[model samples]
Target: MKRLLLERALYPLLGLAVIVVAWQLYTQLYAVSRIVLPSPSDIALASVRHFALLLAQTWPTLGATVLGFVIALVLGIPLAVCVANSRVLNLTLYPILVATQSVPKVAIAPIVLVWFGFGMESKLAIAFLVAFFPIVVDTATGLRSTPPGLLELARSLRASPWQVFSKVQMPAALPFVFSGAKVAITLAVIGAVIGEFVGSVDGLGNLLLAANSQLESPLAWAALIWLSALGIVLFAAVALVERLVVPWGHSGR
Candidate 1:
């Protein structure tokens, strides 16, 4: 168990520590301006100084990210199922999905803000837009990729469509679904931050922007670190869920 923990956690921690130490040394040796590059210690100090403010701002971003990701999963999986199971739906909707994904989210964020106003709704919309594509694509792929032998065996047993789907296809697709989910969750954070950058009254993105405008480099860096931490946490949460729901997927790892 101890070795497992070290293998899973310690290597990454050590790598991050090395990077931080190198960053600090470089900044100190070069006497880099804080505005250009604040050292790790400076960022840490700023984080401590603004802990309350950071915590307060984090809630909005977290809420938007989680809500948007949930919405994506709720809608995307059903759409994917339809597309995967029906030739007609796949022909009609798959093209549309691809086209919509091709458009840049940044370009549409402002229009979304106009529609939903400068509020949580707009952020949610942006997050949903960015996170939706991967979920649909991956899920549909997974469903379609289920082993033909298993599907044929179910059909030979005279299983109903729903039963086959529930028992065979979904289990096969669990890994793919989780893969898309992990990607979508991270993209959701980026989406929320983009929305905040486009128009927002609060959030870590807003705080980072305000700090930059005020030339508070340390604070801006601190906000950036917090955003990274938030993304990591969300990603880990999704991974934990994957481990629970799809335990066999990680057996080799």
Candidate 2:
């Protein structure tokens, strides 16, 4: 188990290290100009020089992403419960949920800005819209997947409905819920960036826009790197929580 865990951790780092070295070698071999693609060293230097400003920009995007994800989480699980428990909602709303995802979030971003204005409100709405469906679908599947044997045992014990749900169904659903949350968190960041792209004056997306407009490739790469780091950090956080809450779920992984 320890060897498995160590390999899991080491493999990604090894892959990343190889990628970075190859990236550096390719740029050097081709004599690639910074205008087209900044070298990793250039990005590192730019990141160091502009760390404070980039961090300041990061705060707003991170805030928007978190708020949007929280809203998605608060509403999604209960809606899933309704859909899972009620035949009517499952038949009606499932189609609606699937349909919502069909409409492109980017195309609606301007209208969302119109509705919620240029503040973080629009960003929140965009993030929530982008992240909501995955959570609902995953959680509903988990809730419905409660084992028949477990349900029968709970009934035999004379457990109340609440007890059965809380003890058996919720636990069974948690790993799935976390899986959706992982996807949602990354979506939330992308949603925030999209909102910023459409209207906002600040955030990493805006920084990227400004940098690219100025032909500051290194700075743009820096912003892109920061955004990627943010997504990775959030995803890692969700994974950590999963390990703590659903230890047995790893057998499948």
Candidate 3:
């Protein structure tokens, strides 16, 4: 395990080092204007100088992401359960859900901003909309995909509905729920960026856009890197939670 992890870390680090070296060489050799293409060192210096300001602005976006993800989880799981339990609701709502996803989220961002305003609420709404579908689909499928034998056994034992759901269905659904959450984390960041792009005057997205307008390409790249890191960190967090909660889920696979 240690060797594998070290190997994984080494390759990425080495790749980054090579890219940075090449970027530095290219900028110097070609005499590229710093405005046009800042070297990796330029980004590093910018990151250091602006770290405090960046973190402060980052907090609101992170908060919105968390709030949206939590809301998605709370509402999604229950709605998924309802759909799983009722064939009529499932048949009706499933197509609606699919149709909703077919609409481009970016095109709807302005409407959501108008409806919810430019505050954190709008950003959260965007994140929620982006994240909601995956959670609902994954959880509903997990619940419905319960093994026939186990469900039959539960029925044979005259298990109460609540008991069967809690004891059998929920456990089976956890891995899928986590899978959806993993996808949702990345989407949550994207949604926040989109919200910022459309309505908000803050967040990494806004910062990036401002940097672009000012032709501060290095700062824009820095913000992009930060955003990527945030998404990766959120995704890793969900994976860690999954490892803790459902270690056996992928034992064979």
Candidate 4:
């Protein structure tokens, strides 16, 4: 366990530390303007100085991201099941999903803002839009990828469709569902930031933009770091859940 922790966590932290030290040295030796690039120390100081404000602004983004991700899972899994099970639905809905996905989220943000306003609703909507795709695609793939022999055996045993789905298919799909969830959660953060960038009065994204516009580079960088941290935390959460629910899948790795 200790070795695993060192390999997975400590090494990454050490690498990051090295990068930060190198960055600080470069800035000091060359006198890089703080406006163009704030040193790590400056960003750290800014984070500490405005920690309360940053924490306050983080809630909205976090709420939108988490809620949107949950919504994606709630809707996407069932949708994937329907599409995977029904050839007609797959033929009908899959193309529409693809078409909508092709349209840039940035382009749709303004319309979402108009519909949902500059509130958390807009952010949530945008997050849902971004996170929904991967969940559906990956889950459907998993369902289809279920070993034919297992499915045939279940059928031969006279297992009901629901029984086969709930027992055989869902278990096989767990890894894929979690994979999509990991991707969706990170994209949820991006989507929330996009909504905030387009129009919002709160969130870390707004804070970052305000700091940047006011030439408070350190504060902006701090917010950027916080955003990265938030994404990492969320991704880690999904991964932890995956490990718990699908232990056999990750045992070798």
Candidate 5:
């Protein structure tokens, strides 16, 4: 078990090291200009030089991602339960939900901005919109698939509806919920960045746009790196929560 886990951790680091080595070599061999693609070392320097500014910008983006993710969870799971339990709701609401996803988020980002204005509200709304669907779909599937044997056993015991749901259905659905959360967390980050790109005075996305406009390639790369790190961190956090919540399961480590 120790060896397996060690390999799991080491493999990704090995892959990253190979990529960095290749990237450094390519830049050196081609003598890549700083304007086009800055080296990893250049980006590291930029990150250090502007650490304070990056931290300042990171807060808003992180806030939006978190708020939006929470909203998705609050709204998605209960709706999933309702849809899973009620054929009428599933029929009426599912099509509309699917239809909304057909619209490109970027196209409607302007409309959301119009509705919520250029503030944190707009970012939160967009993040919620982006992260909501996966949870609803995954949780609904899980709820519907609760084992028939368990349901029969509970019913034979005269289990109350709430007892059955709280004890069996919800626990059974956790793996699925966590699956969606992993996906939604990444989407939340993207959604926040989109909100920042469309209109915002803060966030890594805004900082990125500003850097590119000024031809600050190193700064832009640094922001990009930070954004990628943010996504990975959020994803890992969700996975960790899953391990805590569903300790018996794999947690997809």
Candidate 6:
């Protein structure tokens, strides 16, 4: 366990070290233009200088991501339960959901843009689309495949349908629900970025676009860095929630 923990920490530390070394080497070795690839130090300075602007843009993107993810949870969990309960609904809707995902979000972006305009609504729609499927599929599987013995015991006890579901199905399904939530949170960030990329006046994605237009490579890199950080934060938040809510998961860990 100590070795495993050390090994996990080692990779990220080594990776960051390697990246910094390579960046320093590139800046010194090749006559790479700063315009094309700014030094890490340069990017760091730029980030500090423009911190307020970055923060201002970030809040909106964060808000949209949260809104979309919440919407996904509200919509997807119930839908999963519905499908889990009914073979007919599962047969009819499962394929369609799969198909919906297979279609590229970029293709849907314009339609969403037209319907919801270039505001947070379009971004929220995109985030919801990206997040919806995983939660539904994972939760459905979890709900339907609860431990056979427990389910049998519930049936034997002549428990009401609501009681069985509330006590057994949902609790058993929490782990799977959280698994999907982890995926959804990451996708939510990506979706918000995509929505901003397509057309938004604000967001880290917009910051990236604008920086690209001006050929401000360092600022763009800063936004990319922040975007990655945001993803990490959101993913960690879900993981923390999972650890708190799923006692079995914590005990297993």
Taken over the whole model, the C-alpha lDDT of each candidate is 0.95, 0.93, 0.90, 0.96, 0.93, 0.91
TM-score of 1: 0.96
Q: Where does candidate 3 stray beyond 4 Å?
A: none
Give the per-residue lDDT of model 3 (tens digit) for 1-253. 8999899999999998898899999998998988888888888888888898678778888888878888999999999999999989999999999999999999999999999998888889999999898999999999999988999999999999999999999999889999999999889899988999998878888888998899988888788889899899999999999999998788653
Q: Which ten residues in a row have the lowest lDDT in candidate 6?
A: 244-253
Q: Number of the top candidate by lDDT?
A: 4
User: What number of clashing residue pairs does each candidate have, in the order they appear?
Assistant: 0, 0, 0, 0, 0, 0
Model 6, 13-119: lDDT tens digits are 99998999899789868967877898888788879988998888899889989899999999999999999999999999989998888899888998899999989
Indicate the residue-level lDDT of 130 in model 3. 90
Best by TM-score: 4
* Per-model TM against the reference: 0.96, 0.94, 0.95, 0.97, 0.96, 0.95
Error of 5 at 23 (Å): 1.3
Model 5 lDDT, residue 222, Cα: 98
- lDDT of candidate 2 at residue 11, scale 0 to 100: 100
lDDT, candidate 3, at 107:
92
Better of 1 and 5 by lDDT: 1
Error of 1 at 239 (Å): 0.5
lDDT of 4 by residue, 1-253 (tens): 8899779988889999999999999999999999999999999999999999999999999999999999999999999999999999999999999998999999999999999998999999999999999999999999989999999999999999999999999999989999999999999999999999999999999999999999999999999999999999999999999998999888576
What global local distance difference test value does model 5 have? 0.93
Which portions of model 1 show Cα errors greater than 4 Å? 1-4, 251-253
Clashing residue pairs, backbone N/CA/C < 3 A, model 5: none
Q: After superposition, how far is residue 241 of candidate 3 from its true place, in Å?
A: 1.2
* Superposition error at 155 for model 1 (Å): 1.5
Runs off by more than 4 Å, candidate 2: 1-3
